[model samples]
Target: MTQKYRNYDPEFKLYVVKLMELDGHKMTDLSQKLDIPYGNLKRWKTEYRDQKKKEEKEAQNQLLTASEYKEMYEKEKKSNVELQEEVDILKKAMHIFNQEK
Candidate 1:
């Protein structure tokens, strides 16, 4: 006779890990209560922590540093001033041409 093992989905596995975290439950206690193997619960917790760290690293990568943001703002301000100066010059030239005509 062969024993059948049940497969748990990712969401369920995450939930199980969270239960231990949120409730401060011991792994052995949770394992017995949930009827899951202790080793499986331990592995799930490890994987969840690793995944969260990876996600946090990725998020950090997507964020600009303070210096970077300041530099970008300065560049944009300079570009805006240059554009306004060009517009002013064009307006003066247009006025001068209209007066001559």
Candidate 2:
């Protein structure tokens, strides 16, 4: 007979990752305490780290620094604000027309 594994939520996984990062609990200790497989926990830790690095690299490629991001964000936000104001004005005009009917 095969043993069953339980599903862990995002919070649970995050907790485990924190413990692993802290290095206060050994992998086997965590496995015993959490009733998770030690090998799986190790794999998850490595995958989490690799994913974080990949995401940071992607963010860097997309936007490098805070000032650069703020500049781009401000420009984009200004354009969006103009578009939204135009939309609101059109909506109000449409409402006035509708009410006049």
Candidate 3:
């Protein structure tokens, strides 16, 4: 006779890992209680930890340093001032043209 294999969804795996973390349950205890293999539970926990570390590293890489943020702010402010000056000049030209008409 052949034994059937059971498949678990991602939510179930995450819930099992969280249970172990929040309840301070041992791998053997959870495996017996949940009817899952001990090795599978251990592997899921390891994979979850590695994934979190990778995400944190990516987030750190995407953040700008203080000097970079200041430089970007200055550039945007200068561009905005230039645009306002152009608008003021156009309004003055329109006023002069209207008076001469």
Candidate 4:
């Protein structure tokens, strides 16, 4: 008699791994309970960890660094000050022109 091999989907594998983690079950115990090989379960656990790390790195890359934010803030502040100065000069000129009329 030959034993049948089982195929598991990615979602199922991740679910099993998460179940083990949440229940704090040992690989040997979980393998016996779920009818899976201990080595396969271990491999799935490792793959999940690597996937999480990759996702975290990608998320970090999407955010701006502290220095970059500071540089942007400084540029906006300078622009605002220059605009205020121009407005002030225009107001003074208008007042002088009105006085001469």
Backbone clashes in candidate 2 total 0
Candidate 2 residue runs with Cα over 4 Å from true position: 64-101
Clashes of 3: 0
User: Which candidate would rank higher by lDDT, 1 or 4?
Assistant: 1
RMSD of 1: 5.5
> How well does each candidate superpose onto the true structure, as a TM-score?
0.64, 0.55, 0.67, 0.61
Deviation of model 1 at 38, angstroms? 0.5
Tens-digit lDDT track for model 4 on 44-85?
999998998999999999888999999999999999999999
lDDT of 1: 0.94
Ranking by TM-score: 3, 1, 4, 2
lDDT of 1 at 34: 86
**Maximum-TM-score candidate:** 3
Mark the 10 consecutive residues where model 2 has the least summed lDDT.
Answer: 17-26
Model 1 weakest lDDT span, ten residues long: 16-25
Q: Residue by residue across 1-101, what tens digits does model 1's lDDT show?
A: 99768899999998999988787889999898989999899999999999999999999999999999999999999999999999999999999999997
**Which residue segments of model 1 deviate by more than 4 Å?**
74-101
- Candidate 4 error regions (>4 Å): 1-3, 70-101
Candidate models: Cα lDDT each: 0.94, 0.87, 0.93, 0.92
- Model 2, span 30-57: residue lDDT tens: 8998889988898879988998999999
Error of 4 at 68 (Å): 3.4
